[model samples]
Target: MIEIDNISKHYVVDGVAIPAISGISLRVEAGEVFGIIGVSGAGKSTLVRTLNLLERPDSGRIRVDGSDITTLSKDQLLRYRRKTGMIFQHFNLISAKTVGENIRFPLKLAGEYTRAEMDRRVDELLDLVELGGHRDKYPAQLSGGQKQRVGIARALANHPKLLLCDEATSALDPQTTQSILSLLLDINRRFGLTIVLITHEMDVIRRICDRVAVLDRGVLVEEGVVADVLLHPQHEITRALVQESCPSATTGQRLGLSGPLFRLTFLGAVTYQPILQRISAALDVGFNIVEGVVGRIKETPYGQITVQALGDAADPARIAAAFGEHAVRCEALPS
Candidate 1:
C-alpha cells in the first residue's frame, strides 16, 4: 500500500520557478492497479516519479506500507528501492547485454546469488515473460515488443512488491500494447504486485486500471473507481479524455447541431435497459442517435451515446427528467 500526503513539486526553468505538481494526495491499495491520467503538462509523469522518490517533493510525506520513505537515508533508500521496481516508455536496457544477461544484471549487482543461481533465475524470468527462446539475443536483434518483454523481466528480477510503469506501452503499437497489458495483468494476478501507471491514453487506463485519478496542471482533478469515473465524470478534462477516446465521435463542433445534442452515459445494469425507447414512448421526444460506443473498463462494460432530439414538438428537458436517476443527459443546442 502507498500513501501520499500533500505532495508538491516546483522546478526552475531559465530564471523562473515552474510548478509541476501542487498539493496532490493519493492512496494506492496493495495489489491494486492505479492509473494517473492527464494531457501534456498535467504533471502525470512528475506525480508517478514521486512514488519511488525518483522525484523528491518540495513539501509532503510519502508512506509505503506504513513506512515514511521521505525520511530514509541514501543507503536506506537504495535498499528500499529494490522492493519498488520501475519500467519506462523506452526499454532502457543495456544495448551491449543479451536478454539473459540483462535480466541477470540486477542479481549480479546485488551479489545475492552464485553463477548457477543467476542462470536459473535468468531462465525463470525469461519464461515468465515468454521470451525464453530469445534470451541470448541482443536488444538490437529484437522487435520493439520483445525489447519491452526484456524490460519487464529486468524490472521484476528483484521480486519487487510494487511496479511503477511510466508510459510503458506508449512506444508499442496497438496489438503489442494489448499483449503487454495482458502480461501485466497476469503479473498482478500471480505476484500480487501493486502497480502505479501514468499515461495520457484513456484506453490504457480502461484496459487494466482498477481505479484512476485525473490530473491537470499539477492538480488532482478527479479520482475514483474506473467504472464510476468513466460513467459519471465530474471534470471537463476527464470528460474530454473520455470523449476523445470514443470511437464514433464526429468532427467539428458538437453543440451547434440543428437539434439538441445530448450525451447519454449508460452505467451498471442501466446499459442493458431500453430506457431510450421508454423515454421516446412516454415523452414527446424524437431521438436521432449519432455516436454510439461500447467498451469495457476494468472488465465493467460502459457505453456512451450521443443523440439529437429533432422536430418542434420535442422537449429535451422533459425527456431528461423522465429518467430521474436512471439514465439521462440532454444539452440544448443554440437555435
Candidate 2:
C-alpha cells in the first residue's frame, strides 16, 4: 500500500553535499512485512523516516495507498502521520507516563476521543501487546522488552494502517528479539497492517519478512523474496551478512586443513532428499562436511553445507558438476 518512487535525499555538510539515499524505489504490498537491511551509514533509518515525510527527499514522490505524501500541507502531514505508526530503536516512551497513559498520549494529542473511549482504546492496545498488567507501571519499572511492548502499544493507539519499525528489536537480547519479531508477525496477520522494518540483522529478515531490500552505501543493491535472497544472495555484501547470521560457520583459512571447499545448497524438497548419501556412494571422493545450516527462511526449507574433499580425488569442479547433475546447487569457495 506504499509506493516509493525514485526518491533521493542529500545533506549539505559545511558546503559539501553528502547523499544519504540515492535513486531508490520500492513497493510495499498491503498486509505484508517488508524489511530494509544495511550496515551502519547505509541510510536505512533515513529511508524509513521518509515514509512519513519526517525526512523530506530532494527528489521524487512517496504515495501511501493513493495519496502523495510529499505534497501534503503541514497540517495535512500531521493528520496523515497518525495513520502511520513509527517505533524507534530506543523505546521512545515518556519516562514519567505510566503504560496506560503512554498508550493514550496519541489520542489525547489528537483531541478526538472522549475519556471513556480513550480508556477503552488504551486497554485494548495493552491487551494486544500483552502488557495489560503493567498499565499502572512506569517505563522505568519495566524491562527492556517490556518497554518496547509499551512503545508498540503506544504506536498502535491510533489504529495506524502502516507501521514503520526502525531497528525495533536491535536493543534487545536474542531471546527478546525473537519474542518481539513473533509479536510483529502476529500483529501483521491479525490487523493486516503493512509493515516496513529497517534492520542490520539478516536473522530478522529471514525470520519474518516476506520481501527484502539490501542497501549499501546508500544504494539499493538487492531486492527480492526473503527465501530467494536469504538462501542465495547475489551481492558480496549480502553474502557476508548471510555468513555472519548463520548459526555456525568456519572459514577455510581458520581450519588450516583445506584443499577444496565447496558450498552445497539444497532447496525446497531437495533439502529433505538423501542426495548426499547417493553422491557419496556414487563418487570416488570422500566428503568432509564442515559448516552447515539446515533451516527455513520464512517457510521455505533450505540446507547449506561446506564440504572439504579428502584424498587425491578432491576435484571441486567435478563435485560441483555431480551436484548440478542431480539438480542441486553448489558454489566453490576461495581457498
- Candidate number achieving the greatest TM-score relative to the actual structure: 2
| Prediction RMSDs, each to the true structure | 2.9, 2.5
Supply the global lDDT for candidate 2: 0.90
Error of 2 at 148 (Å): 0.4
Model 1: per-residue Cα lDDT over 267-297, one tens digit each? 6667778888888777766788876876677
Q: Which window of 10 residues has the lowest lDDT sum in candidate 2?
A: 247-256
Candidate-wise lDDT, in order: 0.86, 0.90
Give residue 8's lDDT in candidate 1 (0 to 100).
Answer: 99
- Alpha-carbon runs more than 4 Å astray in model 1: 247-261, 278-286, 309-318, 321-335
Q: How close is candidate 2 to the true structure, as a TM-score?
A: 0.90
Can you write out model 2's per-residue Cα lDDT over 280-327, one digit (the tens) per residue?
Answer: 777777888887889887777888888887767767777788899887
Local error of candidate 1 at 144, Å? Answer: 0.8
Residue-level error in angstroms, candidate 1, position 206: 1.3
Candidate 2 Cα deviation (angstroms), residue 211: 1.6
